[model samples]
Target: MTVKEGMGEEPERYRVEFASGTAASVAKRRSFRDLERNDIERDLPGWPAQPPFKVRGFFGKLGVHVLSATTGLLMLPLYILAEALGSPASPEKRGELEERENEIDDFPVMWAGEGETARTLPWQLDPSRRSWRTVTEIELAEQDGLVRIWSYEDTGRGSRHLSWGGGEKVPGSEAVLWSMPRSEITSAEIKRFSMAESDFTVSFRDGSWARLTSSPHGARRIVALLGQGVPEGCHPA
Candidate 1:
């Protein structure tokens, strides 16, 4: 596999190719950590959320320290055991394990020409109060003469698990966000911002529009997808 980052007008664009004759143009986005932090700060308005101050008084502070130490000591054995057993396998290996465990083989692998794979990007719907509570993973793929915007919502239990015990569960199920023919995309633009942030907007013939505040790489992927003249598969709408 080879990954190369691009520069110039679009800094987030990337091209990744595998030995299997599969290639993809990906746009890098902001880190999930930064997105989470921005989400939290957006909710508190002018006040930024900070870690709670330690309890006042010597005994209270001492008690907190003792509890933390005790917890760390209790977990030492497990840590040693994990180290002895060696680190977990790579994500790809783990994925293979999961597939074998579930007896499944048709799962879609990103950046691979498995199905109608294109560029997968992440966007926050409502960053103000949402934080990292939910994620909208969108994939832009071409099928027939149309471009399908596949949106997967990860909420509730599906949300990312954190060590801080802050995560939402899987809400229900995933659904299609929207779909439009290649010609129906009347206009498209990338709105750049500071701190390597950017937004992508696509206007449909019906006067409706969809906007995604994603990384520059993501915006470029949408642009690239729109520029593709050939449709991968034959299907209506």
Candidate 2:
């Protein structure tokens, strides 16, 4: 592969290695111009399509930011008031945040919500404190011989608008936050349920498990897709 240089800049070189243990789709560059194209590299046929993050290119993003900044300034006092008046994260939760910040900080980590139904919050909340009210993207990809689930912060910095838009762009800087290899994952199925959301467990080969909470519809769907994948850890103490 060759990189182009024209603006008195030195050419940079790089290499990407794929582990044969996993499935991958490879497309060779037809021309040096191929480098200019910014498209998703891995194209999984059966996987879900990416969510939309529309704003256009640089100017479009700039305009949105300017508008948001203007609006945000007006809303600043309300934001400050909300911070003062609204309930804050409990000391324990704050401690947990700091403790796990190193482990996971790009995307919001799981947590209970406010009020009586605290423990029953969605597996991923609408406006998460961890994500600073920004939407975090959950994605599945085949890598390192396993199909893995990944979360990208603020949807890969896709759409920065305040509300009503989302999607991830795998900005290279995006970190793989939460995921376990498919080989290690025994199953991901709902273990408990309520009217609003269902709590599911992701069992592993070692009989260890992680719990996930999702909407009722989403819960069954997730299990249907991943529950039967070499299921084994039925009893994880």
Candidate 3:
């Protein structure tokens, strides 16, 4: 089916090719389960009533850190101080993020086509925008000619500034973070720094842009869905 702007097909217009339990990763399944249980949901304000994508949790995050220490080497600084201080969305902004989320029932999965929002930017590749930085993890759902980007943070990992511990929550954060009509998105592309490093760059009509990243597998899918666009002015990875 062709995607057009302002064409609100119906409530369930956004297709779900697979059911909720059909996640791409084990951590995703566990994380989403916790989200459904209400633990992770409360942390994310601007999120859909139903969660999207199954993401990795405690063990998953740990694995990334372990590997990043080795392979994500040299680029190690990218993980630190990448998310700026005071980066999370404000109360009003959180409400704004939820506004659109409340209108939808389901969200596109973590690895679905054009679901670039499912991944967040690596700390090193974070954009200057505060709104984007605070959202460490995210997903996208498209419907009625608009696409919604949901944000998640590991409340378990504490504040966006501190990666250690602050929250007792076991899993993640949930919120739409914000969304835009399809027309507002100028273009989408993937930038590659190495075999293990890649980023997704999406431009909005307001002259602002969001940079996002995910696992190596997810990054490739992002590039495939979004396509090859200009990367010269993109964030340094």
Across 1-237, the per-residue lDDT of candidate 3 in tens digits comes to 123334664222121111111111231121211212223332333433444334456776577557645755665455454545543322111111221221122222222112233222122122222332244333333444555544444345544444564533225445544455666666765433222434345654443344344554555554454455743432211
Local accuracy of candidate 2 as per-residue lDDT tens digits, 1-237: 123334654232111111010001101101000112222212322223433212235665466557656866787777677679884322111111221211121111121112111122222222212343333333333333343333344443333234444554436634433444556655665442122334344455554333444445555555564564325423311
Q: Please give, for residues 1-237, the per-residue lDDT of candidate 1 as tens digits.
A: 012223322122222111110001111111111111111222222333444212135564466557656967887787777778895322111111222211121111112121121222222232322344444443443334555433333444433334344344455645544345567665655433212323444444443333344445665676565542323221111
> Candidates sorted by lDDT, descending order?
3, 1, 2
Q: Report the CA-based lDDT of candidate 3 relative to the real structure.
A: 0.37
Q: Give candidate 2's error at residue 115 in angstroms.
A: 34
Clashing pairs in 2: none
Give me the runs in candidate 1 sitting further than 4 Å from their true place: 1-124, 127-132, 153-172, 206-210, 227-237
On the 0 to 100 scale, the lDDT of residue 27 in model 1 is: 13
TM-score of each: 0.33, 0.34, 0.34
TM-score of 1: 0.33
Question: How does candidate 2 fare on TM-score?
Answer: 0.34
Query: Which residue pairs clash in candidate 1?
Result: 27-217, 155-169, 156-168, 156-169, 156-170, 157-169, 157-170, 158-169, 158-170
